[model samples]
Target: MTKKTVPVKPHRRSTPSPTPRPNPNKPKPGPKTVPVKPHRRKPPK
Candidate 1:
């Protein structure tokens, strides 16, 4: 009777990546605003 031998392989595990964090001190970019004139009105009939 012959005995069969099984080969064992090494298991490799992947490491978790680090998460990116936002800066709290920096100000957020906003849309541009246009200035309006106060005397810019329509004339009455």
Candidate 2:
């Protein structure tokens, strides 16, 4: 279910792509960043 979920997640995630991305990453590094690193460089499952 977890594996199947990651892709399904991006569906709802599609609309709020930029919304939630920075919301969480905001504290991680601030919204001043390029906003590509966290998504691309993240190693979490």
Candidate 3:
């Protein structure tokens, strides 16, 4: 039987990848600007 050699293939990148969008499942980092605080006032004696 004769031995055969396989040819090596070259690696190539097509184009630059686009920027990824923010994930919707993850919560955003920052305090809310709403003026509806619940723990701001205390009960009267």
- CA lDDT, candidate 1, residue 20: 46
Judged by lDDT relative to the true structure, which candidate is superior, 2 or 3?
A: 3
Considering TM-score, where higher is better, how would the candidates rank from best to worst? Answer: 1, 3, 2
- The collision pairs in model 1 are none
Off by over 4 Å in 3: 1-20, 31-45
**TM-score per model over all chains:** 0.22, 0.14, 0.18
True lDDT of residue 1, candidate 1: 80
* Higher-TM-score candidate of 1 and 2: 1
Per-candidate count of clashing residue pairs (backbone under 3 Å) = 0, 0, 0
Write the residue-wise lDDT of candidate 2 on 1-45 in tens digits.
Answer: 354544434444445344456455455755777656765786868
For TM-score, candidate 1 versus 3, the one ahead is 1
Q: Which stretches of model 1 miss by more than 4 angstroms? A: 1-21, 33-45
lDDT measured at residue 9 in model 3 versus the true structure, 0 to 100? 64
Candidate 3: which pairs clash? Answer: none
- Where is the poorest 10-residue window by lDDT in model 1? 28-37
Residue 7 in model 1: shift from native, Å?
Answer: 54
Show the lowest summed lDDT stretch of 10 residues, model 3.
Answer: 13-22
